[model samples]
Target: DEEGQPVAAHIPGLPEGAAITEGEVNIDLIPTHKLIWDFRIGDLRKLGWIIQCDRKSAEWVRDRYGEEAYKKLSGKFGGTRTDGETEFEVNILDSLNSVLYEGVGDKQRVVTPTMRSNDDVQLDADKMIDYYEYWHKPTKSNPTGTFGIMLADQIMEYTPYPIDSYPHGELPYIPANPISVQGSTMGGVVRISQARPIQREINRLNSQIDENCDVMGNAIIMVQRGAKVRHSTLDNGAGNLLEYDGKGEFRP
Candidate 1:
């Protein structure tokens, strides 16, 4: 010992003038408890120190270290994702506008959303089932189908040749063709006879047929089902979208 301080006399390859001295870290004795390193929970868990801390350790860390420091320390033990690729974040002390709030409401409710992607999210036609009657019009490049089931509540991420406009609310082309093995199952085609006056012709008829229900007045129902071409001249002067169902009942 040199003046009650130990010294290394013969270190291998010691420099000629370099003196052996204690570093600032060497001045203090080794710590009894392991050091809780900053921003590293993986290291602490390896040594098995953490147990149930019911705000006891948190209060100690927060009161002395301040809110920012507490947040960092809390994150270290917040746990990891199921995929093990990301760390899960949580806030027990929920606050908004610096006001601490603990009540649970709609924000905490679990929400399930219907998913739809544009033609971009390619769905396999071979994998499609028959229950919902999904169809994707076959194209040369996409040889299979492109359509999927879309409920009223759901909207697609991208419209795949969709006929719906944002404002018009009519998606005329939904990358799908509603079809079955039997074509035009509802009814057969018909052509008006030219033997009558132009006004009395079925295809070119144009007149009002309105009366009270008590009289049961006759009504000429214009039907549009299947691939009926909507020609500018073939309108027959009828209502735009309002049509009749398979049973000839007026449908909105």
Candidate 2:
């Protein structure tokens, strides 16, 4: 048996938690290595890929802290929770919240929350030019806000980047990105289709406030008649005319 030879063996006992039927043999198993390889490294990669906790991050945590901290870091990110078991990737949402929201647990405040209101979503689109400029800060397109560029480069890289392994949080798209729209002015090209009702309501409220102000204005004024007029009827309302604004001028 020690001599090199092709010896048939029952499926190398299926790896832990494998779904193969018991008593299976590698010889009898369907050949799927090729298909599996394709799935792992093929067109389907667009759907997503694996995100691993990097050695740099692990080493940084460990060196700054200790084995205890390293263990926690690894355990959470892809390290051993137990003696020989470690996770290899961290949660996407938690990572995003920590970086983008400054560690705010309140999901509503998330820069890219799972659920965004029409106004919030529109705001992102409205700031496309600013986003592009900021990310490419100090450039012709963006003459300020280096932080945006720094953050996108550091944490929010997409597609080939590890964050692309995630399928959610589509808000991180910014200026100079493929999704961004080029314009003479600012604003992204995100087409919002459901904000009309809200806009109408806002306009209605403003109109009502304007109307109320008009009524209040009319109510504050008293009709005037010259005091020199023999038949002046306004003197009867002098007390009413005295009602004026802080400048002592008749408000009406």
Candidate 3:
């Protein structure tokens, strides 16, 4: 149940007619050890340790930005018809490319002979091949802020594609095992290395428990050190009796 309450089910063979009390159903919960080796599976799930892939481009944009932002962008930059499926059409890639290459033709791509490097290897930056930069600044009215896909010198309000804040406070990246640190958006740490010591201890304890159980599981008998008792008698008939006569104490 959403509230974590157990919902009762009435089986076909049950006495209740499509409505059974909680007591009527038997809930047999298997032990965690019997089901899985790692008890931290639940914790890992809660921490978002699962594989996922997002193939939908439109939904991806909608998820990062708000629905209004997606609609605005979709209208500003029309989607391409994908195999006659206009409803599922997406132009996110085209929009991004267009934004990145806003003033590509305006920028001077061919460098003069003097501007060329000594090694005759002219880099893209040296040729003045500039691309539009994406900017977003938060305001009191719009907490998500306004988006601007234009040149570095261009102002947010002056951009042609003016959209509101990314209401969905999520970055355009797959969220995995992430660690949070103050004054940092993303932090890195070796999770396996961090858990190595604890895992080693758990393994050692489990090994010790198994060894102890194996040794202690067998029946132990105590008798006089000098006493004589037939070892074969233990496996003999149920009523068979074995007597020890000596005085010194012994343990097996």
Q: How many residue-pair clashes does candidate 3 contain?
A: 1
Rank the candidate models, highest lDDT first. 3, 2, 1
> Which lDDT value does model 3 have at 42?
41
- Clashes in predicted model 2: 9
Rate residue 43 of model 1 by lDDT. 33
* Candidate lDDT (C-alpha), each: 0.30, 0.31, 0.34
Ranking of all candidate structures by their TM-score, best first: 3, 2, 1
For all predicted structures, in order, the TM-scores are 0.13, 0.16, 0.17
lDDT per residue as tens, model 2, 1-252: 112111123235546445434464432211111011224433321212122222233444445456774443332332212111212122234345434543556553456544322443342212211001111112223222122211112332222222222122111221132233455322222222124467889999989977765655532234333433322253332223423344555555
List, in order, the clash count of every candidate structure: 6, 9, 1
Candidate 1 per-residue C-alpha lDDT over 128-211 given as tens digits, one digit per residue, 9 for 90 to 100: 111111222223343332334321122112223221211111111212223233554322111121123554654443223322
Top lDDT prediction, candidate number = 3
Off by over 4 Å in 3: 1-67, 70-193, 215-252
TM-score head-to-head 2 vs 3, winner: 3
Task: Score residue 52 of candidate 3 by CA lDDT.
Answer: 18
Positional deviation of residue 217's Cα in model 3 after best superposition, in angstroms: 4.6
Q: What is the alpha-carbon lDDT of model 1 when measured against the actual structure? A: 0.30
Distance from true location, Cα of 213 in model 1, Å = 33
Candidate 3: C-alpha RMSD to true structure equals: 23.6
TM-score of 2: 0.16
